[model samples]
Structure formats: C-alpha cells, structure tokens
Target chain A: LGPVMIVDTPGMDDEGELGLLRIEKCKEVMAKVDIAILVVDGTLGMSDGDRMLKKMFEERNLPYITVYNKLDLVQQRIGKGRTREVPQDSIWVSASDKINITDLKDMVAHLVVDPSNGRKIIADLISEGDIVVLVTPIDEAAPKGRLILPQQQTLRDILDTGAIGVVTQVPQIPEVLASLAKTPALVVTDSQAFKEVNELVPEDILLTSFSMLFARYKGDLGEAILSANYLDKLEDGAKILISEGCTHHRQCNDIGTVKLPKMIEKTTGKNFHFEWSSGDSFPDDLSTFDLVVHCGGCMLNPREMMHRIRICQNAGVPITNYGVIMAKMQGILPRVSAPLLGKK
Target chain B: LGPVMIVDTPGMDDEGELGLLRIEKCKEVMAKVDIAILVVDGTLGMSDGDRMLKKMFEERNLPYITVYNKLDLVQQRIGKGRTREVPQDSIWVSASDKINITDLKDMVAHLVVDPSNGRKIIADLISEGDIVVLVTPIDEAAPKGRLILPQQQTLRDILDTGAIGVVTQVPQIPEVLASLAKTPALVVTDSQAFKEVNELVPEDILLTSFSMLFARYKGDLGEAILSANYLDKLEDGAKILISEGCTHHRQCNDIGTVKLPKMIEKTTGKNFHFEWSSGDSFPDDLSTFDLVVHCGGCMLNPREMMHRIRICQNAGVPITNYGVIMAKMQGILPRVSAPLLGKK
Candidate 1:
C-alpha cells in the first residue's frame, strides 16, 4: 500500500546470549529493509557497534538516517553540561516530548514514496471507460456471505481506475459476456475455474487468473512461471511441499493435502512425498524440500508473500502457487499469463 | 558391482494390518526392481492376490517370471491326486532341494547385465594411457585413514579404463601438473578445493569436481546447474537447507552448520535462515525450505542419491551439493565444468 510498511526492530548491539540473538535478528531485519533509522542515545554518543552498522548499510548501498533520541534530557542539561555530537544527516527527537517526531515522519515519507512510480494494480491494464469481468466461483470453499480479499481488491482496483467491473460466477460468464455491449477490456477469474473461463473468453479479450496477478504484484511471477515446467520431470518418490495462506478451510486442506498431491502423482506417475503448511508462520527450514506449492494467498499481504518468495529465491528453491501449478497442469498457463507477457 | 546387489522384499498382499504395511513396502520395492519373481506355492495354486500382483507388474511393464516353490511336494503328489495347473512361464524350484535355481539366476543375469552400456565413471573422458590428476584437500574435514569413496571409485575407474591417475593435495596441484609426463586427459578435485584447484589447472586440461560428476552419474545435472543460479538471488532472511550424508564427522558439522552458512551470508551480504540434516533419513516434508545444499554423498549409493535428486526435481526445488555451490560462489564453477560442457 504505497510504501507505508514500517518495521520497528530491536537494538543491534545488545549484550548477553539473548542479546546476541537479537543482534543477529537485527541484521536479518537490516537485510530486508529499504531504509534503516539508527536510533542513538545522544548522551552516550556513538558506540563502535553503531559505526559498524553504518558501514554495513553503506556496503549494501542502503540509505540510512540516524535519529538522536532523548532530546528533552539534552535540553534539560544545556546550561550545565556539554551537548552530545550528532551526525550531520541525523535528526534530534525525544519520545517523551515528541520533539522533531513529525520531521522524522516527513523525512521517511520523502525518501520512500514516489508519486511518479505508478503503483496502481489494474489501472495500467484498462482505461476509464473499459469493462472488466471477474469470474468468482461460489463453492463449498467460499466464505459465508462474503467475497474473498483478492476478489474485493480486484474490484476496488477496477473502481479506482474508473473502469466498470462485471462480476459473475463461472456458469454465468458466457451470458455476462454476451449481455455486455462491448467486450470487456480484461477478464480475471478465480484460478479453480481458469480453464473453463479461458475457453469462454474470446481470443481478443485479455485474460488472467487472480493468483497470477497477485504473484506479479507480490514479486514472484517469474519464479512461479519457471517452476511450473518442473512438473514434467518428476520421478518416483519426489517431494512436493504444499502451503496455504489460511489453514482452517476444509476445501483448501483437501486440495493442498489430498487433491493436488494426487493429481501431481498421477500426472507424473511417480509416488511423491507431500508436506503441508498454512497461515502466517511459514517454516524457516526448507532445505529438505524439493518444491514449494503455495496458495493464492488472498489473506496474505503482498509484503508477506514477497518475503516468502524472496526466502525461497534465496534458498535456491522454486516456488509456485496453486493457480499457476493447476494452470500448468491443465495446459492453460500460457493463456492466463498472456496479458502480463505482452506488458513484459 | 555386476548386478550383484540383491534386495530381499516381503510378500505383497499379506493378510493382517501389519501385513498390509509390509505389502505396501513390497510394492515400493517392486517399483524400483528391474524384474519381479512371483514365488507361488505349487500345491496351493495361484490366489486372487497373485493374479493381482501379476497384473500390477504388467501395468508397470515390468518384466517378471513366476517360480513354483515346493517342487518336492508337487513331485510327491504326482501319482496321488490331480496335478495343479502351472503357468507356461514358470519354473519349478525348491530352496531345500535346490532344483532349477541356477536357471533362475541365469534368467536374472540375462535380463539385467548388459556389457555395452559403458558403465565406467570417467571412461568417456579419457583414452587408454591418458593421465588424470586428482586434487584432494587433506584439511580438517578429510578422513584420518584414506581417500573417500568417490576418489577411490574414480581411481578404480581410471585403472579399468587404462588411464593413469596422479593424485595430489591442494598445495601440490601445480607441482603435480608440472611433473606429469604428458598433458593429463582430465583433472578432478575435491569440491572443497575447487576454486584453488581451478586456478592451478591449465585452461586446456579437462577439469571437473567429484560432486559435479557424481551429480551427473547419480541423477540430473541440469537441475543442479539451474539451481546454482538461485545462489545469486538469495536475499536477507532467506532459508537455506544444508544436508550431509553421514553424521559422525565433527569437521562436516562445522562446515555445514558453521563455515558454509557464514561464507554464504558474507558473500550475499544477507542474513539467511538455515536448516541442517544428516545421515540416511532425509526429511520427508521439504515444502518449507527454499534451497537444499547437500554433501558429495560418499556414503550414499548412486541410486539413493538419484532418488534424492529426483525428489528435489519433482517438488520443483533447486538443489546443489557443497562443491557446486562453493565453486559458484568462488567463481570457479565455469572452469571446473568446462570439460563436461564440451561434451554437451
């Protein structure tokens, strides 16, 4: 959401066993953050650890701004004691008095947010007057009396872009298309009904799955596309790890733990080992696994999903979501990815 | 050795609950076998399960022959009662009497052993009287007594192919090359010394690592190469799974659990999540991992390693051994792979 994600991390140079672990954890956080704010105690001045961290940031070419905290205390001792030296590019702030806190927020905003970057989701795909169709399948898996996040987000994206959205289930997709005066600018469907929707949509109209769009949005589309090809080379006793964003739904559990595994085994003609994970706490250890199959991640924010993807990429693991994997299995991946392919 | 490995499996289609698990185990064994022998009790005749087992083998297109057991009992009943119907493709054999067992052995030998497959490890790389240099590092990780299995096997392969093998440690590689009488046909090095050995070996000489060759001999080389690229893209907080073949060595523990992770983190400038596994029991649930780094697997047979590789490939996970990863990290992977690349 427009670069508003802020992560508050612990001090990097803590002492003792747990402190050492915290320092390691700080380094991990340091690697993932775009910009870091080093909070320093003004009275104590800068320690060697602070200098080391600043150098670490400089080595990665990661920009960092220092914050001098406890400005109130510094001010209280102004007449009696010497003022501590602050870095040239740093800001002075006090948590107790909220001194220069607004300036800190403004500085962060200036550094991170770029209005010209064009961060809109589907806005680039369609113009103000264009009609966009969304095919949502209402099945046992569908939540009671509510649309899932991805569908809602897609609808909102269309609305925000000033485009008209025609929402319907899989069976009504053909009728909905016929009833419209002009062909929709794009058709996005739930991945489960991708094959059916692909057939119903005309050749000229752009089509893609919701999962694929999310994958592109979340920064793992290339990896998902690349990993889809691996399904063909599976041999006996191959392992496939299936994960989902939400764990409680019976339908997702069935698909992840049972149906998908069965389909993969049958398609490859190989008996495979299957592992399952769900919800937000993704496994940290992934060395034993060969492949990771994730869900559409409707409930997960793009940042979380991207982190998961980045983790996989770093580990040299290939990862794909249910939509892409199923699309590949059904021979409709090329069609679903056509719209994005053109832009690339 | 010469089709000498024999796997004794339990009977399929056994009766009780425990027997059912054994039966499943039998089917797994059957899946890996080149040929199946159905030992039938001559007097009892073929049961429904036996027919089912035969059908299963037929479905897999696995070649099979039937063996009629208790030939002595059949002989005793010859003049007393109606004779059982024996299949045309069956042989009468008695373990106690040792009847027609030699024919069964010959049949197995005829089906499995073929001399023309060129099973030699590096025979294709060298001609008779050619010299090959091996660079082994006798570091802390090296065994106290002798060379590892891959090195020993490579030596044997060279001898079998009428090629001369010149062995040396990392420091002695340059001297060994200078002293050689002729240009060596190939140079192989322990994966740990890949970078150093790569620089010392002449550009014209063929070169490869023990792990890379083992990767090809055991299973998929393409997968390993593709997975190696993933090392370049790892981010901070990425998960890396490191595994070893055997468990007892303190040296491997330090490298796997300590040194390699440190090297990777330092090189990538990103803190990573790490997982470790050792010995014969690999983790079944590999879905949570992003990458798997394995050992050269001297303790593991080619078949087992191949199965592990296939498992990784099928799951769409990228895998590399310690050597390939280190070589790539050290910028020596291309030089080491040059010889194999030429063949390709």
Candidate 2:
C-alpha cells in the first residue's frame, strides 16, 4: 500500500469489562485508519460480530476488504465447493500456508487513491533551463551540514522540472545575479532574510520565500493572505495562538516562539497574550483565540494543512502562516506573494 | 538539540518492587538515548539517587548535563553564593520563568557533531552541466504520482552538483541517448530493468541502479560485493535470512519476497530454507544462517545500516543487499558495481 498504515485491532467479539475497553479502543482506531480489514473464520462463516463491524464500516463510509482466513482448512473440509457462497469481493487466504495473500494485498493497494496527484512544490512556476536563485543564510540556527528540508525539496522540484537552481547566501545574492549570463527568472530566499533579499534582488525579477512557496503548495494561499492582512486590525490585548507542525526543541532564535512574536508585536505596536502549541495536538476549539499564526507546515501533508485551515474557517478566526506573516510585516507581502498568486 | 531524543524517566528513589522495575526500565532507556539530562531539585541539591544515576551514566560512557532547577528558590535561599560548587557546564534555571533555557539548549546542540559531514549521494561523481540520463520504468509497483525517494534524491544530488538530469522510461532510453547533445556522464536505472538497460546503454557510459548507489552511500560496498559472491557457494539446505528495512505489506510483485527468491533459486539451483525479517528486529545470533540478504536500506540511516553490517561481520555470516545480489544473478555484477567501485 502507498503511505498506508495498517493497525491490527482486537477481535470485536468479547465479553466483560476488559473486552468492552478493547472494543472501545478498536472503535477509536477505526476513526484514524482509512480502510478496514475484516478477518473472518472460513470454517465458521459469517458471525454476528462480523455483521456488526461491517455495519459500522458502512455507516462511517470507510472502504474495507473482507478476508476469510484458514483457506487450507476450508479446502480440506468442503473441497472448494462451499467457497462459491462467499462474497464476490472477499478473499480466501491461509495465514500459515501463505495462500491468496498476494491477492489480499493487491486489494488493499488498489483502494488507495494517489494523494500527491501532480502537486509540485515549485516546478510548475518555472520552465526548463530557467534560472532560479535561492538565497539561504548560514545562521547559527541553520543545520550543521545540509540545507533544511524546505530548501532541499524546492531545489529538487526545480531540478525535476529541468530548471536550473543556483544556491547562495544572502551576502552573495547581488554578486550571483551580476555574474549570471541573463537575469534569473525568480529568486527565493529564507523568510528570515526576506527584507534584506527584497532590497538586493532587482524589481524585474520575481521573488518569494521558501515558506511562502510551501504555504501556497500545501494550504490555501488566498485565505492565508487575508489572515496576514488581518494583523493590522488586532487590539492591544488580543489573544494569539502560535502553532508549529513539528515539536523540536526551542532553539535560541526559534521562529515560532521568539522571532515571530517579537515581530508581530513590533509591527502592530501592541501587547498581545500569546499561547504556544506544537506537534500533532492542535486545539479543536479555535474560538478562544483572536488569531492563529501557524508554521509553514513542511512536515505536514496537504490534507492536514487544509484541515487546520478549515478548522479556523469554521471558528471564524483569522489564520496565517509564518512565511506569509513575515512577508506582511516586511512591507513586501504583495511583491513576495505575487509570483505564487499568478499575478506575475 | 540536533537529532536528540529526550526521555523523561521516573524518579529512581521509589520504594518496593514497582520502584525496582521502574529503575530497570530507566536503565533500558538509558542504553538507547545518546545523552542524559539529570534534573535535580535546586533546594534539595544532590541526593543518593541522583548520584546513583550519575554513576550509571558514567559507567556507560554517556555524557550528561546536571541542571539545578528552580533558580528563584535557590536565589532566595543562598543568593547565588553557593552556586560556585556547580559544574561549569551546568546551569541554574527556572522552568516556570523560562530563564537560561536557551543556554541549556545551546549546550545540548553543541554536544552533537555534524553527522552528514559533506556526504554526497552522486554529486561527487559528475561535474557541472554533465548530462545524466535516468531510466525509470513506470510499473505497477511504482507509486502513483511521483518518483520514489531514491530517484528523487539522486536527481536532487545531480542538480546540486550542477548536472543536467534527463529522465526517460526503459523504452525511451535509446531515443533519449540519441537526442542528447552529448554522451551522458552516467546512466542510472531501476535495478529490476537492469538486463534491458545493460543492453541498451553504451559500455562507455557509467551505469548503475538506484539501489546500488544507496548500498555504497549507506553501507560498505566491498563487504556487500563479497557477500553477494558467497551466494553461489551455499549448500542446498543452507539457511538464508531475507531482511527488509521497512515492514510495508508485500506487493504482489514484491522484490524481496517474490522476485529475488525466485531468481536466487533459479541461479543457484538450491532449495534453501528461507527465513524473513523486517523492520527494526535483526536476529542477534546470525551464526546459524549461511547467508543474509538485506534490502537497500533507504529507510534506515547510515549508522543503523553499518551497525547491521557489523553484526553480520561479528557472527561470521556473509551479508548482501537486494541490488548487489540481483546484479550477481544477472551476470552483470561487475558491470553495475564498477560505476560505484571507482573503476570508472
């Protein structure tokens, strides 16, 4: 299966207190998994437990595959004649003998629709042989050896599209552009150095940040832009929730905790009560907060990022990401977002 | 912290049988963690339990940082005069007040040496503007929308080195070569299509598979090559262990369980007793097995892959990977391995 997680749960048919707890756990797991594998005993045929599980799956609109195990015993007892009564989509397998296991796997794999259906991080923005310069500052917070995941992925996407990628630090951007045979098609920089890079790169060249590119690629760009602009309307005592997708240690210059908060307060010139959240636990109730400023969400899938946006939409709260907010604060939101918004 | 895993252990001073089990569990966790943080109550100072934990860490050559928390309480009691006795590396902090937390994080990050250390997947092999044709066969096992990780990573590496990457399917290899302005520096393909690719690609062009490139990048290529040769020497009933780095469901045409086993039996004309292992569990005692065939280990880090190789070396059992073995059985081992062996 492609990017599928198969969780094995306890049998639904059980009695007593412990059994009920196990059943509750199974139901909880059912909400997380995309599909279900209902294993039945071929010798005994369909039971009430199987019927109940099937009904639950149907009610939830969860696609599933029914598998009748112990095919060896079934063959030994009924000589393959009774198997005709089994459902059309059901597969008969012997766990020990490895019979029809491949068929069962194929069924599971077929159920998965491609999630990354022709989505590109930046490849779609440029053509083959087009020069795309990336400005990455080697700051104290930068990883020791290689570039960060967003930069690496952007470079890879550009390469996949047959576009030329030129990487340089903030200081070398002017020289890199001067030395190029022709003016580069686009320039991308780290969000933290966006102000300096915006000043360095010429007005003719389209420019954006890694975070901005990912915001458009992974989530709703139009909504994020609207939320970024909403920063100006916040009062002095507004409640802001700062969220990150991954839970790494707080670095000395952590963007979510330190830089972004300082910048937001400075831009609005207002004191705001800030709350921090990281990792998988996003608060379901967003109504308590006046605004939610989230990370670029490189670690999260598009579905999750969209879900967070939808949650904010449902709660009537403004939600923006780190890159979009930084661009907004730097007074170049339109210039930085123009390339991604199809205004270039 | 750079790639650090911090585990909060239960206090070691608990009483009775449950306390002893908790202490044992802490010891087990200590073995897995790279460094330890011994948090001590600032008021109570060092206790016997703390000393015992320190001794255990020292015995295991595990580096540790001792933090005396509740700086406010310590200041109230001693007014910072008694802090001279604390180690130079240790810091006083108040978790609630968020004091000196950044210094503590900086200390942990300093402890980690850069792991990558300028390692390149294929960048070192090619120069700027060097054309590299990649032969990718779109098959049933291929992911729906995007290329697999290895291919994506290799293409990124080539781009990072300023090389031009031309991607084509197996049938288009000839046409891609014909249309190229110059002969490509290297031609890489999926290992499953090696036989056809070998015939289609010119002898002068450096050729290899994604799996073969990863074998060298992540593990010792010489060891893998030797182990692959040992496959021919196996007796009919020799015990062989087939291992995969990831534990995904077996696809109908899975390379590990289906293709490799079939090829191995056909080439060697032997019916060996095969055992399968996947994910993190590697058998400690490999002396019983005559040979171990492993996957390319793209899912695992370089350290873990090398550790597995060392385990095989210690047990005096030959170990090889899927790509190397497949090359050997196809009688193109020398041709494929040469590209990565520095012979080209």
Candidate 3:
C-alpha cells in the first residue's frame, strides 16, 4: 500500500514536427521515476526508439521490465503452444486475450521501492484511535463550501492509519481543546494562522502545518528550511519571485497575493520588487530572483513539484514553500522542524 | 457493465445552518435521475428524515429501493434466522459484513434505463472497419500538446466501435481524403472550421462537426437545432447571452469570444448587445436575453447542461449551442442534422 505510484508517458517515437517535443516530455518524465516499463509490440519486436528508451532507463540506473504485448497475434500466427524467444526477464501478454497480465502486474508491484521509507505525516508518530486536531481558518481566500486539497489529503492519511481527525477553525481551538475528553495527540493548522494557533495550543502538544507535512512528502523539506534562512539576508529592492500552483480570482484577503506579501514586508522591514507567476508557468531562469517562494504545491503532482525544486536548485536560487516561509517568519521554524527531523 | 452509476450525495438529514443549500443540491440531482436508493440504518429503522427523503422521491414519481444497512447489528439484537418485519421490497444487509452487496449491484443494473438506448455519437451509422476522417485545427486556443476533450472522446468512441479513425489537420484534409484507399464513411471537423470543411468534404460523404455530435450525445440536439431557428427573429440591439462551460484566456482567434461574434454579425447584419458568462455561472434568470448561445459543453456534465437548458426553457428563451448555430448560419444545418435525426 505504501509503494510508489507510476507516471505514464506518451508514445516516445512520434516522428513528426512535434516528435521532439514529445521526446522532451519523456525525458522530463524519466527524471522523476525510480523504475521504467518498456511496452513493445510483439509483431514488430523492439525498434530503435525502444532501444533508446531502454538506454535512457539504464543510464539513470532505473530497473525496468520489458513487456511484449499483442500476444494474441503471435499465437494466431504460430499456433497456441509455440513459444517465441524473447528478452530474458521480459513479460509477454495480450491485453485483449487476457494472457499473463496478472504476472505483469505482480512484476510491477515487486519493482516498487517502499515509498514510506522516508518521512511520513503521522503514521509513525501516532497509532489507531488517536485524536488529531486540525485547525483550518475560514477566511476570504478559502474556497466556498469545501476544504482545500492539502487538508483533505492529510485528513485522509490520518483516517487511513485509523486515527480520528478533529477539525476546528482557528477561533474554536480553545473551546475544542477544553471539550475534548482526552488530550489530543497533535494539532495541525493552516500556516497563515500559525501565529495565533501557535499561541493557543499548549507547548506540550505536538503541532505542525499541512504545508510542512506536504513539503517533506512531495518535496525537499530540509532544503526548504535551509533556503528560508536566506529571508533575513534580502536587501532593499531585492527581486523576489512568488509562484502559485493554481490560479483563481484574487479575493479581498487572498493569502498568496495579499497576506504573504504583507508578512514578508513586515518581517524584512525592506521593500522589494516582487514578480508573480501562477499555474504551470515557472520561470526557468531563476538567476534574476533573490528568493523563490512557491505554494504548498497541493495542486501539482509530486513529479512536477520535484522538477520545479530541481530547477531552482540548479539555478542556485534559494527556494522555499509558503508554509516554510511563514513558519520561519513567525520564529517557529526550529520548533516545527523538530518533530519532522525525528521522523526523517 | 450496464449498472446505473451511484450518485453519492451529502447526508440527507444534515439539519444545520447549511441544510437549505444541501437540500437545494439534492433536488437538482433528483431532477436528473429516474430512480433513487435510500440507504438507512437498520437498527434505527426509518427516521423522520428518511421518511421525508422517501416522500420526495415518490413525489417525483421516482422508483426507490430502501437499503437497510448494519443488518448484522440488528441480527445480533433479534437473534440469527429470526424474521423481522420490514417494508415491502426493502433490502436489509450489512456493508461491513459484505452481506447482500451483490444483490444491491444486481438491483442497480436492473434499474439502469439503458443509458445508450437513446443517443449515440457515431457508432450507429458506422460499422466495424469503416473509415472516418477527423479534421482538427491546431491553433493558439489548442492546449499546448494534446487534443481537446471532445476530439479525444470521439476518437475513442470510433475505436470502441471498431471503426478506423483518420486524424488530420484542416490544411491536410484534402491530401488525406485523396490518399485513402477507400472513401471514408464520414468526415467530422472542429466547428470553428466548418465553413471550409463543409466545402471540402464531398456531397456524397456524410459530414458533421465535433460540437454538433457532442450536442446530441451529451445534450439536447433536437432542441438545440430548434432554438437555432430563432436566430432570424433577432432585431437590431437585441440582447444575446454567450456562455462557455470553461474559461481560458481568449486567444486572438478564439472561437467563443472572437469568431462566434464575428460570424453572428456577418450572418445577421444586425448589431446586438452581448453578455458573456463562463465557468459554471449560468444565469438562472434568462428573461432579459433574446437568445442564448452556449458552447458544445464538453467540459460540463450532462445533468448540468440539461439543468441550464431547463432554466432557459423555463424562462421562455431560445437556447442553442455553438455548432448548431454555426451550421445554421452556414446553411448546412439540414445536412448535418439529417444523419443524427435518423437515429433520433
């Protein structure tokens, strides 16, 4: 259940005007995968494109399985009992005929590295039936009538581990804590409300933010913390980039555009030039920016977030997510980073 | 495979501050369904809320199957194999115990109104191995490197029906047709290129647009075509509403904002006031508009589109889709509507 998920790519050798773009896409996909599966046509055997794909996997030290499909056609040509020679450790199957598909599934399952070997949200810290309080602030920036993806995903993870998630807003935390029959195991809050919630929750209880958990899950949390340390070094008129993963109409009190910028200006006490990019458009050339502050990346896939992180790393720019930045600005970076470091 | 898809709704008796909105959502869902399944707790029997839900379903003349869950608890209370009174035609089972779940599935399959019994895309006209030509225009509005949803769904339908789909751009349609060993059974194009495609496709070969076919499949084609007839009745300075199911930055040559308006002005030679709405903000009150021209609605679900159509119908306003209007303006509405009507 804790196995890594697979990323599907397009047909590699679509030899036309856009073939190069498709190949470029494949290379990007290759950067994020730990293993690869090469599907080949049984009738046509392996082509040059397949060989190049295999080489790419091998160059990256990715263990891969070669799957020969359309076994029905081969069976029809040479009769059912006849077996043709295939690559060693390759799987031959017919999707339509239901031939050896289960074996292929088992092989894929066996190849997955344990995805939970690294940091986890709460499974290692708490056990079944433990109570975890989640503090979500209902503000102008919140989507109407629904919780955002990060909170929903974190709650789902806790449920999966058989833990009870007690949801409350920032204002109700004091009342919720008083009403609870037993002391809660941990308190997680939206980073925007960190200052107030940090003050409300007792120092004895474990506390964190959704963004901090996700940063460690899908991105480099240690690096994010290290980069956030650069916030105090910014000079007046230093260029900063603010990137959001999703684009929606900016509300009156939108956290990304309004609240975060205000916090940064207040903390640094220096006016800086700010550039903004949202939805899929991340600047490849990060050389111009003193710092890059990205969203918590709930809308983005793990691979895409990782790719963006690597791009920032390669560009030698200090990159930190919204939550990490806010936590650092609140002077709670060491306190929050303590819980995650133990799990790591 | 013929099972009726489950519609997961909020807890019916959510009697709290937002209960009115929840009830409104339920009524909207009820309008689109033929039958309802009321699941209740076995131990609790029928509550007032359950009775209300049943009455609502009955008022709409919807057949319902009452499913009493947690039968295991009831059995433990009353002793196993002892009969207890239940409503006629009611099912009692435990979900956690995996009891009578198959019976529930069979009931759902039996209740399905055979969704495909009414409208189909292209499967009715073409047989196995028949060739169909698809003309797509790669323009600025096109998503970076993939076919739009309608085109992808149509191509998939063709493949599912065992028909061959030949894909080409607007410029290559001529070469593709000439190079084909056998004449294609049909030619379909993007509605934006209907003028040129209608001219290029032979008179003998059946021709249609993606939007036209989708209107019939996902929406009301007959009503759409009928509403298109109302375009001639518009006067100078008449109010018209243009609604798109999704929003994007309108490119210089985008169909919805630029091309459609241009076509309307040229065809009618009467300037009209235009009101635009995009992305799920359909007006409930349409009395101000003379006509409503909507997108093909590939992004919208069938229920949502039908709800919008019903709103327009209730307002006594003529509502039509983009493809139907364009075909009518081009004087090809009769030709395109012919193929769909035979099946209708």
**Which candidate leads in lDDT?**
2
Q: What is the lDDT of residue B86 in candidate 2?
A: 78
Between candidates 2 and 3, the one scoring higher on DockQ is 2
Tens digits of per-residue lDDT for model 1 on B104-134?
A: 7887766655322324467677776566776
DockQ of each: 0.01, 0.08, 0.01
Model 1, residue B304: displacement in angstroms? 66
Task: Give the Cα error of residue A270 in candidate 1, in Å.
Answer: 2.3
Model 3: residue B198 alpha-carbon error in angstroms:
69
Show where candidate 1 strays beyond 4 Å. Answer: A1-6, A28-35, A52-63, A79-89, A114-120, A138-146, A244-255, A278-287, A297-311, B1-344
- Model 1 docking tier (incorrect/acceptable/medium/high): incorrect
Whichever of 2 and 3 has more TM-score, that candidate is 2
Q: What is candidate 1's fraction of native contacts?
A: 0.00
* lDDT digits (tens) for residues B126-183 of candidate 2: 8876767777665656554356667766766765565655666676566556554467
Instruction: For model 3, state the Cα shift of residue B33 in Å.
Output: 5.7
Q: What is the lDDT of residue B340 in candidate 3?
A: 75
Q: RMSD in Å for candidate 2, one decimal?
A: 9.4
Q: Which ten residues in a row have the lowest lDDT in candidate 1 chain B?
A: B111-120
Clashes of each: 7, 0, 0
Cα TM-score per model: 0.45, 0.57, 0.48
Write the residue-wise lDDT of candidate 3 on A1-344 in tens digits.
12245678877667886888878778867765656899998899998889889988888766799999889999999999565788676989998989999998888777754433354666666766566777766554454324555665665555545555556666656755665556777788888789999999999888888888888988889889998999999899998898887785353226667788888999999998888888767877898888999988776756568878889999899899999999999999887777677674
